[model samples]
Target chain A: MINFTILENYFPVINKDIIIGNYTFYIKLYQDKNGYFSLEVDISKKDTKEKHRFVQFLLGLGKDEPNELSCHDSEVPHFKIDYYQREEEAFSATIYFTFRNIAEEELIDYAKGTVVIITKMLRKYFENEDIDIANLSEVVYENSVISELLDYEEKVIDAFYICWKEGDLIVRQKGKDNFVIKTKHNLIKYLNFDYLKPIYLPLKEKIEINEKINSSSQIM
Target chain B: METELDKIQTTITIPLGLKNRIRKLKGSMTYKQYLSKLLRDRNKLAHNESYIEIQNLVRKSAVYSFGYYKVTFTYNEYNNSENFIFDIDIVEIRNKGALESIEKFKKNMLGSEKLQSYQELILTHKLYFELLEKAIQIEIEPLFSHKSRMDDYDAWKKEFESLGLSKKSFDFDVMRKLRTLENQGDAF
Candidate 1:
């Protein structure tokens, strides 16, 4: 096997979240062969109508410098939303969620956390009514996805974050104009999130959720 | 006239290995100086009988349709000189049915507005080999011819300069030629 440790070393630690309507939901990271590092959240049939509404909420988190957001409904049973940044290089995060067994309220509550919100949106899109949540057992990570993430991580370290002053704000409110709004949001902004440093989080805690899923699989 | 020329030029049958060694040794020498030295060496050790001459070297571009090879010579050269020439030929290899499928491919390709020039195609195929041979001849031949003058950097520099070539200029010329060639096909 080709040693992909070099590639895996560069992936930014994505702390993902999902939101359905008003609530945040759970999600799982899946590496796809087409160089997509996807977050999937599985929900139930009742929350199907809120799929577009949930995606709109994600769009509201808005964009940070160097990040572009786009949505596609080109696939059946799932809506694919992609967030990408292209400059001298590119970084992208795609969320695939399928609406399954979970409620819309639970998904909305889950969206309070960044990781949970992203996960809930993905779960609602990727899961089909025919697919059993219990049967989706295999966790496969593509080598290309791992390599791409590693490349993105290196670029993130090398690039200086673009800082914007209040003068650059597009919205000029007459009363609150003086307030210096320096906002960094989205995947690019999350590069600064404190939980990302692998050294701070012990390996045991890092694998906590993954281990739980694995153990639960064994019990089933 | 041919009989008189044959009588004047003595047939020298040197071993292939010896000839190769001499060729390698004469690598840093000028062609004139190398030939002179080789003549002297041949006269001193001229006892061999069997002689083999490489009359010609031809490079052909062959188009295979289905299973048959339809070959046509693209380039040919004949060498009647005493010394053997070692010019490397590099050819591009395609699939067996490439020519037969060309009409279909051309139809698809012509739909695109951009077309490649013939000069560009030829240069892209030939430039590396040309550079390699020229560099080897200029740099290596003189040193082989004169062992005593091995450290003569000035001589090597003069030869290199005399070639009147630069990597940048060569690349530019190739691109320019390619552009001209590409335009020719469209005009016709």
Candidate 2:
């Protein structure tokens, strides 16, 4: 079960965070007063080598602007890098994935895409670290789904639980307003494509092919 | 014919001059009733003034003060309840003292035990933090890159001037255009 915090003080800011290895991934879905929605993810870690590796990974995605990087294969818009030193000993580099001016109906899809990208990055980070990246991705996916449900003001949230059935996730709300949400994990990868022509094809396949080609190549 | 229930009878020691002034001001009302009315009016005046101050603060909407943050309390006419928005601008939080004050404010007001009751406050605080987080990403960190770019521009300008190139060859307007392009190329 993934824990999600629905911050009700403001306009429906939902936080679904996870920590893997030394990195902490802070994911948020927010709606502004102007009714525009944004999904922001900040991936931060203190290790210097991790920062270098992360930057290298970002370089693989073409740099659209000075600090903005974009993966043409993914549904996510772009990524920005920032450096923070809250304390002298706690310096960290953070990668911020920002999607602004998104519509409410499209928020869930963007949120899912954000989770997928973060999962992909974590999987790369833990490629040789013996960590179960698949399990982590599943948890992140479930957390994102829960966040989406919470965003719709789904009542009886405490009664809800998610379980894996075959290759899909089954979310059941037990008490009043009972319902079940059965979704394929890959459905999240290719929700809707407004700009891209191929709407039905999962973008993850393209990303995986690119990753495979890059891995096989000797280019640093 | 004023009912006794509508008034409270009381006696207190006071200067004779004050008593004479009170008697003259009391007019058609009892002195005790007038004094109570004065107390109520004074309280109302203070309350109204504070409300006005809060409204003004909200209107100003710039969090520029040092070591202090503002929370404007507003009355919801429809619900007949009080609500507040925690307003803080990350750019204006200039000094370490101001940062310390924010830390203390969050600690005292956003403590876990007190937070359950002020869930709205927590949510509002989180919103401000989100804004600040974005500001840090977009504004604060990019400052270094901007500074280095400016420095490069400055160095280039110095080198060009030191070269003693004919000033009449390049128009001032052309130089200004180039400078703008160089400085603003990568700026958002």
Candidate 3:
């Protein structure tokens, strides 16, 4: 009973065959069982095991520039695209556009525009060999670390001042403990080992140590 | 010492049908994991009054075997005369298998979609209740007194007949009732 008139009209008119530079893709747009818009992009070439790498690379690009390819109102990009192996021939990929904000009028434009952008990104990825797939995992890990750090605040540990506030880390000089610098960057920015020497301790031990330091400072 | 304990095995002799049912329900999970999950469900059931009533009633009607762990499950044969005895080592209606089956059914019903229609929600609630009822009948009914057993059957029959559902659609009526209550902001 759901309306598919807009979706049906759009896909056929656009012609499933899409040519982006050297790459040719056969894109089929439809609604999946859960009633979400899904775009299945099949690589024209029979040998797509190599081409699946480009799809992963596109996902990596989306993560890097989330603002461009992010879900409706979310800060993080939609990462539901799955590429499954089809026999011994090729790999087929499906990307779901699960945005609640997408309108009927904008459906065609959104799907087409996204496809074009993604295709262009894939083409660029194929041209460049510098972008390693491993770097994508690293970027994802770094973002998660930043998110986890943002949840808690550590005021003073040892002689250094450290606190995470509003996606920025505020830290003071290690040995000098004089100058305070706040930066909106990865933990690596201050993890140089020169400015700050990071120590590994159990949370219970750290809390006990902090309490002891607080009591000593109060007495002094 | 721990490794030696891990090598210990316990024998469980149950009704062939019940064993088959357990095997089907415990898909992709080991027996220990399934039992552990069931124990969690049983602990959760402590907070639910109606489900506790069903469980308690089954326990009260049955006679416990002394010394060795022997429990009875009555499956009425042909003329509702013969009792099917399940010689299980464990305690209380073999709830581990039953609970895991219920959880599996629930997951399958609510697969991916977060939003469900009134009828769909009702159906899901009813199906789970019926599953529990079936489990009770299979694993605990044999030990039930004739009067007690008839009373339970009549109670379920009256409830279903009130909702205008056939015996085959037993689970559906429960679903509609639960769904209606849930939508009206009543605890289901």
Candidate 4:
């Protein structure tokens, strides 16, 4: 089984254009041994109307074959969208897929293709005039900080995990930096890393130490 | 995205044996003229949206009629840093059924005939590599340099790094191994 999570913060609002609201976007994907894969997307509840519209747009697109390959419900497919209100707001959607004797390479290809399609849909939604295109790009480009860690020379690192804490998303760079960025309701309009933490070697060493301690405890 | 026209040019002398072969071929042209023609043909093909069609056209061009060649150069950048990379790859476009033809040709030829043809083809390889090396030096090298803005790299690197895990210890070897195994497909 494999699990992947993406967290985005600091959405942008421009020129009082379109709707003025704060938003958070989270997407999770999981694949199980039983040849089943699931995708979950969570957005702020305040943006429920827009989220619902986005969902409907996806459903419409899915119904229409945009590329050479299209997804249909009959083959290892099921999906659900859930909405909830917290102190802020959130929207959640999940997609499950059951594979049919497919090779791992095929599964990986499907996952990559699905990610591209979903991202394209979101980009279209955010860029549509009905939605704030400029602000959407700004928010996504600015607040989506995870790309930095991912692009690190593949020789240096492999993967990353993010955690939410104290209303802020804390980025623990697996072995290096642990940066805690304060959440903003508005789209991220400005980004300056002057005060951000630069936890590199020290955090990695600490993680190594902790692992050793945990293993020792298990033996004891 | 304005194409930079200023290029530093360099030339390397071709060996007499290869030059002699070029002289013997009908409709033969100088290396530079041949390359210029190839580039012109490639440009026309590239503008066409269909890659497969472009591939076909490229095979019919002078580059293929003569032989294969490779052109390599660093792209434009600032601060003396080579930021961009460019290559003008030219390869011989064989007839659609050339591979099968070559196999048949090899089968029909006796020992001495096969030896002579193989020896002659080596000269073609040498000329192709030489033309490729020189074209890149003259046409492509000048455009490459460091990007104008310092913040670009930092911001790009930051955004790039953010896309994956930051820790150095994460083991992606499994993912790579899985891909390799999948590619090998029961061979292992």
Candidate 5:
């Protein structure tokens, strides 16, 4: 592995993410506490809540495949970097790759291949997207708040819940509704938003918090 | 006499195709009710998604300030369920200096207008998180990974032995483990 400082100086400060198919590729580029620059990437599956099993299969954790010599021989070689699964969630698992201590020249080359491989594999296994490396390039240096809200919108889909002063709001999912907040606060009540009308802001327009405050009618 | 029937009595015309389409929709609700449901559902869907995002953030905790109050969420993300469980602490600015800052923050929020929007946003986020967390109780890699297809792990050694790859890769411990796995049929 070589070290690349130019790619490390700025951009992709951990919060840049792009959603492709049922997976969101979150890229975090940062300098560690000791000022060691590292690039980390994680692919989270939004559909399948699989974890270790997925990682084990991916890392070739334990196996003597028919022709492969070392377990690392099965993976890493083709992608040009070593990786393992980190941060396993119920419906998602983060495929983590650390591009630490890599030269700028080699890092760029390695990153391009990596992006290509990820695009190809996601298309191969999931077949839910027509995305390519170009789709990934835009994920660099996005506005954090919009990205956060957008990420929230993408992940949450349509499943919502509210707990303001108990019986304040509701989300409309079919079948039984489970809006129970465990706190013993007596004033809290759970109600569905379907019955309680509220605006769907994103479906209309994006809300920039700073802009909302600065340009609101009251401020005028 | 103005009766309930008078309130209900109204005539509206719809194209035959739309009327048929509405009739084909499978539910006991009337077309009017269903259309109204769709309209309301747009909002629910937006709120629900924000809600889901907050619940997902249970991987760690989140704190948001609304000037008058600040809500801190500490999540127990160790469970595998639809419900996300968390303890919430609402902190108020009681100190005189902090109270002034809170007032300044509230003023900057642009009084009622921004307050309403922020209120809806947080309410929606909290509502969705609560719903998804309602509960609660509670990989890997790569292109070359194509070769490591997990399904083969249970029996790959037998296949490898037959294929005559490299016995060196399968050490004594690994071989025994593989044999045990082979006999157990993935009991682990």
Candidate 6:
């Protein structure tokens, strides 16, 4: 039997929660399973919807910096830290860091140091997510009830979105403030052009309650 | 009359010892043929002829798609480059996304810290050899494959650089972030 000291000693992976700048950062490690085990670190907030998106936006802002990393070493230090960028979902965001390949023996004397350095690097950018979070307020989605935007514009409707399908918001025409609305159940008919305060929490609850009421009456 | 594509001339200098070493292994290949063949097989020597790692700095693309066999290193602007070379089958890691492939290009202009470029060449003494693993695995052809590079290649670069990681800075930020793992180590 092989005596393993660390979790990564057997397999190649490191994942956990890190506390820096008074905020808990959820990070996970993915190592290449093929030749020289390359590693990637993903950082995000926990539980909140912004957890997914919080890191992606922050990384997007720093994509232009000159800190691209890669490792030329082959043994254990065979890893280099590459680039950082955003991984975006429909409503979630995450940021991750890529390293070139690194060997396992590096952990004998260097693994702990490497892990500490990476954490310090993460803390250095604590201000990356320095944007004001808008209170969970009313939101207006003309379609699928999955998204809740913190902010948007009303100058012109550019496109309509559904789960997997989308159409042009409107044809680009000079001096045209009017556009057609397309959807099976569009609130556009019942909505004022200027009043757009409809978010999903209240809307979804209303739908659920109505369905329950209709079912009760039918059973009665 | 020989056509332009038929023959081309270029000068290369090599130590006499290295040349004799290559000649003993060349067998019947002409000097020109040997030089061309040597360039093509330059990557295998890195790890003593087991695998070849192809990393193109220009496109920021990297691939380890060869075994201990006759390999080809074709550098072209378009196309995947080496498709005709037989006796070698390999898989490629598909996460070569660029966070800003041009960061080094910009740094070169801004006159930042000293920049280092990495280059690995492969060379082989023999032409081809059957992989012992192939017979054990009962496989016939090499499959071009891709593995997950990271959570997100581009996103990782952005966060890493935003922390001000230059060779000169030597700040704790670069060290911590680079070495840090999620909730790993004896902590767990």
* Docking quality (DockQ) for each candidate: 0.01, 0.01, 0.02, 0.01, 0.02, 0.02
Residue A54 of model 4 has an lDDT of 22
Candidate 4: C-alpha RMSD to true structure equals: 25.8
Docking outcome class, model 6: incorrect
Q: List the candidates' TM-scores in order.
A: 0.16, 0.24, 0.22, 0.20, 0.24, 0.23
Candidate 3 per-residue lDDT, tens place, B1-188, comes to 24787679887776666666667888989877787786665454222110000000112123233233223322111111011111111123223233233234334455666635553555444433443344445443432222233224456655434422233233222322343344432112
Q: Candidate 4: DockQ?
A: 0.01
True contacts kept of each: 0.00, 0.00, 0.00, 0.00, 0.02, 0.02
Worst lDDT 10-window in candidate 2 chain A: A154-163
lDDT of 2 at A5: 21
Residue-pair clashes per candidate, as listed?
Answer: 60, 1, 3, 43, 28, 52
RMSD of each: 29.0, 27.0, 24.3, 25.8, 27.4, 24.6
Lowest-scoring 10 consecutive residues by lDDT in candidate 3 chain B? B49-58
- Report the lDDT tens digits of candidate 1 across residue range B76-159: 222222221222222332334344233333334345556455533443334333333333434333232212232243443343
* Stretches of model 1 off by over 4 angstroms after superposition: A1-220, B1-73, B77-98, B101-188
The alpha-carbon root-mean-square deviation between model 6 and the true structure, to one decimal in Å, is 24.6
* Candidate 6 per-residue C-alpha lDDT over A60-178 given as tens digits, one digit per residue, 9 for 90 to 100: 00111222231111332221222212223112111111212223442323333333333333433342455222211111111211222112211001111121023222211123342
List residue ranges in candidate 5 displaced over 4 A: A1-5, A8-14, A19-23, A33-38, A43-220, B1-119, B126-188
Q: Name the TM-score of candidate 1.
A: 0.16
Question: Candidate 4 residues B121-177, lDDT tens each?
Answer: 433333333433343333333222223332233442332233221111011112211
lDDT of 5 by residue, B18-76 (tens): 56656877378987678778656544433221111112322444444443444333333
Quantify all predictions' global Cα lDDT against the true fold: 0.29, 0.32, 0.32, 0.29, 0.32, 0.27
lDDT of 1 by residue, A147-194 (tens): 333333222111111112111212212233322223433222332322
Model 1 chain B: which ten-residue window has the lowest total lDDT?
B47-56
Residue range with the least summed lDDT across 10 consecutive positions in model 5 chain A? A55-64
